[model samples]
Target chain A: AQSVSQHNHHVILSEAASLELGCNYSYGGTVNLFWYVQYPGQHLQLLLKYFSGDPLVKGIKGFEAEFIKSKFSFNLRKPSVQWSDTAEYFCAVNAPLRAGNNRKLIWGLGTSLAVNP
Target chain B: GEEVAQTPKHLVRGEGQKAKLYCAPIKGHSYVFWYQQVLKNEFKFLISFQNENVFDETGMPKERFSAKCLPNSPCSLEIQATKLEDSAVYFCASSQGTLGGQPQHFGDGTRLSIL
Candidate 1:
């Protein structure tokens, strides 16, 4: 079984401040990592994902997450966050490239980010 | 289209009553998943259906939780004799099954409140 953990429960930041949210998983084999965001009343949407190739994966809204396999971390980062970026971000993990029944996602508790103007 | 559609944005039910949630998966998608998000806890996978057949239901509480997906109809998750612990946002997501590089499309979720 695979599990995901997000260290931050809540984060407060001022506009233009940099952002980083830590995510780690417990799977030793190959895995897929994802970052999803939910705005005030919006549905959860995919921010980025990492499967293979480059360790650094860039997503929409200037968000990027780096996959550090050795550390078991895929931390989400943004150089400058805007007020509109205040939302709940979740880190999710899935088992490696199995043909079937391996695409189920295990999600983290989510990190609430509040960017004050 | 919004990819996935979940009905009754919010639902309120009394204990010992029944609550039902509906999810319409995106066209051409064969995989549908249900998850519950309780306060202070991460989203827990409830059940998953590949087309009309259930693929996995290990996370679903067998005693009180039941789900079904019919042909040409949206999938439904029903809770019999609901309890306070059932209060949470239930999300429905769909994907292209066990394929490569496909992400789940989530709905806004139906917030279930049991009194």
Candidate 2:
């Protein structure tokens, strides 16, 4: 079965500090990768996604993720994080369109980040 | 609508009572998905629909959980008999395309609390 793993359960960092959250998935076929962030009391929003193109994808709030096929990893990174950036991040993967009746996303447990102001 | 809209931000239900949730997918979006977010930030996909047709429902319990997306109306998720474990935040999302690569846009979830 396909599975997603987020290495960090929780992380703490100071404002302006660099941030990196690790995500790895186990899937033998082509997959669509996504990183989503949910702020406190807000809806889940897309941070970035990787399909068939460039490995390095940039997202909103200055967040970026790199897809490494050999590593089966798509790690999210930001040069500097603000207090507002504190939220839960989730990594998800799904087989590209061909897998009929199996298009549901396989999600990681998620990483909770706390940024001190 | 520009956004996927979920009605009733919160719902309180007694044990064995019925609970119903609503979701309105964004205009022009043919794919609708429902997910349940429980403790530990775990999200479980419940069901998905493609223009009122069930696309995938393998994740749904099917015993008491039922969903539908009817024409000219919001999609609905209904629980026949609520249990304590049924309490969770339910989210609805929609995408314009049928491909898995299409990004899904989400709505503010509905918080269901069962007593």
What are the per-model DockQ values?
A: 0.60, 0.58
TM-score of predicted chain B, candidate 1: 0.95
lDDT of 2 by residue, B63-113 (tens): 999999999999999999999999999999998876668888899999999
Candidate 1 per-residue lDDT, tens place, A48-74, comes to: 999789999999999999999999999
DockQ (0 to 1) for model 1: 0.60
* Number of the top-ranking candidate, with DockQ as the measure: 1
Question: Which stretches in model 2 have alpha-carbon errors above 4 Å?
Answer: A96-102
Against the native chain B, what TM-score does each candidate's chain B reach?
A: 0.95, 0.97
Q: List the residue pairs that clash in candidate 2.
A: none
**C-alpha lDDT (0 to 100) for residue B88 of candidate 1:** 96
Residue A12 local lDDT, model 2 = 100
Model 2 chain A: lowest-lDDT 10 consecutive positions: A95-104
